[model samples]
Target: MKPASKSPSLKCLFLVAALAVWPLPAALAQPQGESFSGYLQTVAAKARREGISETAITRTLSGLTPNQRVIELDSAQPGSQGGPPPMAPYIARHVGPSIVSRGRGRHAELSGVIRKVEARYGVPGPVLLAIWGHETNYGSYVGDFDLARSLATLAWEGRRRDLFEGELIALLKMVDRGVPSYKLKGSWAGAFGYPQFLPSVYLRLAVDGDGDGHADIFSSPSDTLASIANYFRDAGWRQGQPWGVRASVPSGFNVGAYSTRLTAPRCERVHERHSRWKSVSEWRALGVAPMAPIGGDVLASLFQPDGPGTPAYLLTGNYRVILQYNCSNYYALSVGLLADEIAR
Candidate 1:
């Protein structure tokens, strides 16, 4: 039985060849240029089976056409370019004085409602304001693309068909829930509302902040705050902990030695920049001192964003929560710093 055993190299080559010829699933086998008309019919059938109403489905999906602009925007996401720009410049621009000032003003303006949201959800008010400020400039704008059309276009584009198709279905459900179709406008990628939430997120987490019996995140600041806080809380934000702290590392400390071996299941690139988790006391023993107070027992990861001799931070679990909102080091850091500035 062992007479015809293959060499290891030959086996490896055979495996590679097999993988190269492996059959894709039927769903993926469909051509990228598959007719949008057929795709819509399939999606509409699925929606009907899922109990979405006829009026809702017709209102949103009937005669919907793919948006070329949405396709352009999705294809042009920042990650498609070369490696990300330097983090310091990114931080400078995003967390600059203007956002800080606006965030502080919004903090004061929304203090009472922010307090109520924080009391219920345990997320900090300034953090909420920072997110609001960053997402839509404190409700100055919330994009203008029709969400139904955008979702349908992205779905028909077939690059991320499953995701956009599901989102399209969720949009139909939102319509069924009495949300008017005309109000469904947002980013080219389909996030809408003051909090820039996708349809599924609005269904799951959006809350009525002012007890108006409607979670009108589009125009109501109170609903926006509550909805955002609910998102943070669901993402596991901890109370009474700073997202991170400015830290100073010792001379000749080998940050490379501390690079994490563990891989994240999602947002792997964003997670790669973080050093392995260590207790604050352990980092202190290694001469990594926090410029501000943090509990010695708290577990934190070192992030030398610009490398040694530059600004470093010891980030906590709350920082990870911020990353959950938007999976970028630059974005999370900006939000945390902006929040601190607003609170200060």
Candidate 2:
């Protein structure tokens, strides 16, 4: 799910186009000891050890070569490991009227299916729709890179060897179980299917949502929504709770006084910008109020993405579940805000 950004942090088409213009052959351009064949051999051995049959390993990995574009995109990822960027533009672009309108239309078309998923997973249909819309524009473009090849190439590149290597082994297992290689298409990083689920994630959490014997997230909207709801369920999304709501913060309120002090083990910088958890009652005391009133004691956090001069938000833990989907404040905020508009 990390590869395909809600905002397309790196466009696959552009990366491919860039590679097409390069003068050198991709395989010969490799550095010492990281040849594509060697990578495949290593991954194939690992897969075999993990119980994937040797036949499947050979069939899946044979003739596979490195995808230079994956390395290029992975290395040059913008704003990665950088500070939290201003959310104003990201929110404006991602949660604006265009996306919201399309989301609502899709919502109506899939209302019944969405309700079933929500009932089972305790995740809102609009939230699922927002994720689906953001991930691949409601499955308009689920990417075209072969997952097995992409993971194999990235693992071979050795920059983030452990992560991609694991994914490669997982893909091999999926192949051994009869998942065709051709159906596994996604971003250069191997985040495939409608929700852009990585191979690891798909293996652990993917469900047969449409009850059609398989969870075909690539083309089936029902399976896609169900799979998304399953993801949120596994991520600990709270049922019957709002993800977040725009809020009014009183002037002269020292917003920084409420900022989080602890460093998160992961996405630390992204978590830093968030304020400590405060009940709605505490916020009400500070003259902070959300657009909707569930209660005054609901545990929540404050986020002034554009700072005090602009509107702020009171986000609940369910918002964190959305964050688990992408870990980007921009991505999570947009998905939550878009869900609101979609439901509205």
Candidate 3:
């Protein structure tokens, strides 16, 4: 009989190949000393494979080097080192009087266009303004980083390679579509324009609200508002429904019994603080009455961020939709509260 074969089985071979190319976890240090030029070559090859125009790749990627500032900013992002800061303080800073005043002014100033967009997309005008106000302070400062350099540097850093790499490719495709190079400036994280959209988001949802046939979110307030409405609509913002309402929780009610057992795949920590979904009437029976009107049968979750005697809320599905935009309770709540203030 022949000796047993030494070659590995097909399944073993496949597993070995997979392991060779698998990515390291974000917590682990990336392999060092890879040439940035060589990394760009691979990205260019990917662009070509994805059918990005050679002219676009050559024009945008040529002579580009990794941005050290982008790497520095990325490293400084908040992680698991400490407990989160208080929501009361964050809300005070982000949704302060200045933002509220500006938000109402913009709401009134753009009322005509806002009405049109709201009619088309089923998103409220004040909600759109709230997002705009929060994103870039109503376009006062939309960052000044070169998006190509920022995206490439972040990708090269390898902490979030797949995400930033895909964004870089999308940026090249934007170039292919004739967006000017100078217009490709935004946050150090590659989000650009008045709405602070990533390249992919711009490609997918940006629309021309002014009938110019060009979706210029960089300088056009109408386009920015319209694009934000489109994003909210896509995220399932329910028209004619409130995002949430403040609640009066009884002193003896055990909020902990209603804590959500389901873990969210993304932003699990943020979602963990939310109570289980219950109908508005059911919550009313439990002595958690909404201060403002909400439909009796509507499903909502309870959020009591600061414990007893602090402000509480009954959040609707629209609140979850807002979370999809930024994934922070403080952000979503501030947006809702800001929208209410602007509407008033």
Candidate 4:
């Protein structure tokens, strides 16, 4: 019927084959010979389809350059200091008296807010204070790299394209929503603001705590604390539980046998410092006593940062949440211990 119609599927396949064999147009092949202005036009078109305004796109991408330093810093690992330095040396450099003193001062200044934050998120004031202290020295040392430019450069370079592209889009959205470009400055690794949030985290967890329309972590103490609390809450922070408590391991306990052998999916190095997890009751049966009285039922794991004979701890699930922010056992432990000291 009707001259034995050629198969429609066969025609589609032929079309696909032809297209595959054909060379792409020069404009579509690579980002070649396009002036920055022309590139901006294409990016703006894409942004518009994604609901970003032209003004926002212009403001964010104008005068942007790829940050070579950001790429370099991103590739560098944390403990690449030739020989592994002792825990005390690392802690001294990161969690010094200055951080503790400032954390104490910030705690005093934000006592009422911290109490509200604790009531809402179940994370303690000092723990939050410690994170604030560690991330950016309580806002005193928030980074100076241009966030929009850095994210854009990372996206264009296309190494971690999926991750950085999404972040770059988020940065455009931030600019569209009235966050000034100057305020978009942050760390070389793309974490920004007073609490050192990545663009994605800021989009998800930042809060307008002071009733201000903007969630300005850089200048607003209330917003920073609220944002930190929000992050912990989102990361499964349980209310009324201590992160971890100091504990004494029993004599003759096989420290090497119980040490963590498996690498964590995230925060592998941090997890390596701690012994394997066991329920609190199990630890207690093995002669582990809470170094400090902690309220509520909490499942915890044993940790000895400086091996078995050092200051040991029984860390709770909340401690793991802190590790999600920065996967360093030393960092999380210092934050927790410092927070406890400040509270005392």
Question: Taking the tens digit of each residue's C-alpha lDDT, what string does model 1 give over 180-267?
Answer: 8778999999999888999989988998999879999999999999999999999999898899999999878888899999999999
Off by over 4 Å in 2: 1-32, 79-83
Candidate no. 3 TM-score:
0.90
lDDT string, candidate 3, 1-344, tens digits: 11222344565444433423433334433435556666777887788777776666766776676777788899998887776667788778888889999998998899999999999999999998998988989999999999998998899888899999999999988887778998999999999988899998888889999999988999999999999999999989998889999999999788999999899899998888899999999999999999998999889999988787888999999999889888889889999999998888
Clash count for each candidate, listed in order shown: 0, 2, 0, 1
Cα deviation at 182, candidate 3, in Å, is 0.5
Global lDDT for candidate 1?
A: 0.84
Top lDDT prediction, candidate number: 3
RMSD of each: 13.1, 8.2, 10.2, 10.3
Across 1-344, the per-residue lDDT of candidate 2 in tens digits comes to 11211221234234323333334355455554655665566675566567776555656666566677777887788755655578888888888788888899999998889888888988889899999989988888888887877887777677777998898887776776667777978998899888999878888888887888887888888988888888888888877789878889888778899888788888887788889999988988879988786567688889888776797989888988888889988899888888888988
| Local distance difference test, each candidate | 0.84, 0.79, 0.86, 0.73
Worst 10 residues of 2 by lDDT: 1-10
Compute each candidate's TM-score over C-alphas. Answer: 0.89, 0.89, 0.90, 0.81
Kindly list the per-residue Cα lDDT of model 4 for residues 178-249, writing each as its tens digit.
Answer: 778878888876788888988778878898878869899889988888899999999998877789998888
Of the two candidates 1 and 4, the one with more favorable TM-score, higher being better, is 1
Which lDDT value does model 2 have at 313? 89
Ranking by lDDT: 3, 1, 2, 4
